[model samples]
Target: MRQRTGRLLGPLLVLLLVGAGPDGSGETVSLDGDRPGERLDVTLTRVVDPAGRADSERLVAVELRLENTGSVPYEDSPAPAAHLLDTAGQRFTGTAAATGAGPSLPDTVTLAPGDSASGFVTFRVPAGAGLAAVQFALDAGLGDDVGHWSLS
Candidate 1:
């Protein structure tokens, strides 16, 4: 009975550790897409309302850190494909207008093994919209891998 219980706890412990964020705040996701061996780690570093309006719309800035954990190079533009989802199921794409509101992510990114990049992606949502999560992807969402960070 002790051995059986140990086996059950072993896998459960690994699962919890693997899913846990380093700082206990953001999430880390692998961006393999069609590549079998590619492993890119994306972490949501911060998210904030930068205090301003864009034609009756409020701006939300999402800060992210991307690290190349695989053995190969990962190159793509993540800013254009980043999105904001509201509680009402409304999806808001990253906006260029909000770029001036914060330090925006580069239009192109090339990450070699062990390389990392950090920047912000901004979105314009309705004035009173309740943001639920932020969705981010490479290749303008054409890739299979997508990372989501919950706001609440």
Candidate 2:
């Protein structure tokens, strides 16, 4: 009976894995045209507001794509900081008081020439979290081009 159960689960797992497709990031992305040694090309995608549809408390996340097209590699501290500007223009992270807080995971990355990375910028929205615009700023290893986004 156990052997039969294992056989059934194997095919199911394979089917599930095969169905997951590539996310929107794919072959058609273009890096910002900046002079080498200038800055990283950051393309803001979406802001997942923590406030639920009803504006209750939930997890807020920002998503963007960062690519290094410069002559030298992007340089940053061991753990540089990412600041998220809430609707009120207050920083959500990296300030004395976390007006809004997000998961403090590793939250760091570096890119060699022509390297690109994508993921969500997660945070905790205050009780009165707004579901609109959130601005993001990167301290280092990034270019002058800032990222902007709006949630539904």
Candidate 3:
């Protein structure tokens, strides 16, 4: 009976950990991409509001780390599409104009198996807006698999 309990406990712990989605800030999420056998492990490393202010809109930079954990190579020439949602349910798309906030992600990245990359995706939000979450997807937001990270 002790052996049986130990066997069941292992899988149960795994499920509990994996079932907990990336709802907490700084948690890593594993999601499949558009292609078969393609998986990406993503983590929201940090979010920052730079000190400089050149416009009325605020620039929120989200730093992310992406790793190719599957067998196939992951390639996104223009980088993945990312969206920032506010507490009021308003959504904002990623903007290149916000690159001034910090070091931006490369326009293109190709990662082989076990490769990883880290960069920032910036969004232009209202000065008073409260951020809620961020959504990232491959294939320019057309992919079925979208990974979400809660910011609140």
Candidate 4:
């Protein structure tokens, strides 16, 4: 009986995951100026699933494009401090990398005016947590200069 249940669960899980649809749709977000002369353009390209099995947590990688449109250069990185927001209002913190899988952002990115950078921000969320959007704080933990991308 136990063996039979296990066989059935595998297919059922696959079907459920398939029906969840592709990575969160791309969205554009404008970042605020942490200082008087800082502006940025952010685009959430897509949200991808982990290539390997997610036995513990569902680690999703968010692809993004960051452009500095301000006069001063962006002297900080956007990957290590990114966060994810789900439909249920739960927030998932971002990770530098997904253990051993997924892409990564640069360590020290300095985007000058008109310069742009593209990379991934990984987040570890609970399995099947309906992700609604991604939030980025330009100043890391400063809670200033924020940009939000709606996945829905």
TM-score of each: 0.75, 0.51, 0.76, 0.72
Regions of candidate 1 where Cα sits further than 4 Å from its true position: 1-25, 96-102
lDDT of 2: 0.42
Clashes (candidate 1): 0
In terms of lDDT, which candidate is stronger, 3 or 4?
A: 3
Q: What order do candidates take by lDDT, descending?
A: 3, 1, 4, 2
What is candidate 4's lDDT per residue for 1-152, written digit by digit as tens? 00001112434621111111234345455565557677777776767866334677777888778888888988776765578888899988776674444457776668889999887878878787787767776766244545555565
Order candidates by TM-score, high to low: 3, 1, 4, 2
Using TM-score, give the best candidate's number.
3
Lowest lDDT block of 10, candidate 3: 1-10
Candidate 4 overall lDDT versus native: 0.65
Local error of candidate 2 at residue 94 (angstroms): 7.2
What's model 4's TM-score?
0.72
In candidate 3, what are the lDDT values of residues 61-122, reduced to their tens digit? 88878899989998873234778889999988875454654677777778999999888887
lDDT of 2 by residue, 11-124 (tens): 462111111112212212222323546346655454444413324545555555667767667544212334554556665542122224332223456778888776565555
User: Per-residue alpha-carbon lDDT of model 1 for 30-149, expressed as tens digits?
Assistant: 665446556677777767775467798888888788898988788777777778889899998874344544567787788889999988887888899987777766656555556666
- The CA lDDT at 53 in model 4 is 44
RMSD of each: 8.1, 15.7, 8.6, 13.8
The better candidate by TM-score, 1 or 2, is 1
